[model samples]
Target: MARGKPDLAALETRIGRDFADKALLRWALTHVSAAAQRPDSYERLEFLGDRVLGLAVAHMLFEAFPDDSEGELSRRLAALVRKETCAEVAELWGVGPYIRLGEGEAQTGGRKKRAILGDICEAIIGAAFLDGGAAAAEAIVRAAFGPKMHEAGRSLRDAKTALQEWAQARRLAPPRYRLASRSGPDHAPSFELAVEIEGFEPAVGAGSSKRAAEQAAAAAFMAREGVTE
Candidate 1:
């Protein structure tokens, strides 16, 4: 880990929100492992922030994609609000260094863990909401996540769902995923899975988890089939 304290002021500038209650921001950044008491940790804030993120993203989608059907909007919302997306946003804002982890967690590189980063991102949103109410929280969410909505060729729907739908549209069996291989140690394992649809060539994809591997395989199939969702 880097020496000395992280500059919270700089983080505020990057996030575009200055906390009236500076302590709240600090609270949000405090990992459970680092807290004196679990109640003082980011868990509660993360829960509230999760809801706030959904609300803000849902509102943004409703306004920006007026022509999109409810299903489309819902798909977009899911893609944007997922933990991976939240972790990506936190990385964009350089939040890892600011996270307060216990020495054990820090030694294990907790700062860069996607799950921790994602939860901290939501905790920060929850902090913003409490510090400045709905308007402030909405503004922060929009600034952080809005541009992601228009990234070129971004898949709005879950790949697994889209692939299943694609197969159903053609009266084919639903996509089947089989674990082709597994490698790496127990602490950090890698998975390779193949997705197959009847009458179509199978596609292979890899990830750290089975579900992620399945999604990757489905997405590969969709790309090869020229499917858009």
Candidate 2:
């Protein structure tokens, strides 16, 4: 970590709302990797932020999608909590540019890392909650997620879950994923997969990793099924 402070002023601009307790915002942006190098990193605050984030999202989903079952709400929450989604949210404010990273973490694309960005976003919410309470956090959440929530209402479906639900509801067998193989160097690997749905032709998918490939396969199957609801 650098001896000097990370720019809270810039972060406030990114946040679009200032914190009463500025320290909370500082801690929220602080990453564990950064903290290891910096005097005060955001892990502790991140932990609090993680819980606050989950709760805030859960409450919002519960209220907004009244007819949605717990399972449905959980699915939406899962989609939002993923590193990919969080990183996209951070990208809105160029939040990555403001992170205080350790010497090593900085060198290897830490700024754009999805896991780091997601964690930081959660920590910031935690910080916001601490400084300004649920109301402030809610404002941020609504603004950040407004578009996606509206879109989800028009058409919302997750392939993996949809496939599972399809099988269960029809009293058919569940889908199966076969990791056909993986290749590439240790730093990066490519995965090939074949998803076998009973009574249907297998679907193939490739991804940077096995899990990703499986998800892709699931999505393929979902598309084939014309997934809805």
The best candidate by lDDT is: 1
List the candidate 1 regions with Cα displacement exceeding 4 Å: 1-3, 163-229
Give a tens-digit lDDT track for model 1, residues 1-229.
Answer: 2479877899999999989999999999998778888899999999999999999999999999999998889999989987778888999989988888888778777788777788889999999999999999999999999999999877677789888988899899989999999986543457999999879899998875687789889989888989876
TM-score of 1: 0.75
lDDT of 2 by residue, 1-229 (tens): 3456567677687677788887677677766565745447776666777677677778778888999988788888877655456667777867786777666667767787666777678778777888888888877776676556656443344566677887789888888999888885533346889889788888887865566677789878778777654
**On a 0 to 100 scale, what is the lDDT of residue 159 in model 1?**
86
Worst 10 residues of 2 by lDDT: 150-159
* Candidate 2, residue 38: how far the Cα is off, in Å: 10
TM-score of each: 0.75, 0.65
> Candidate 2 overall Cα lDDT vs. reference?
0.72
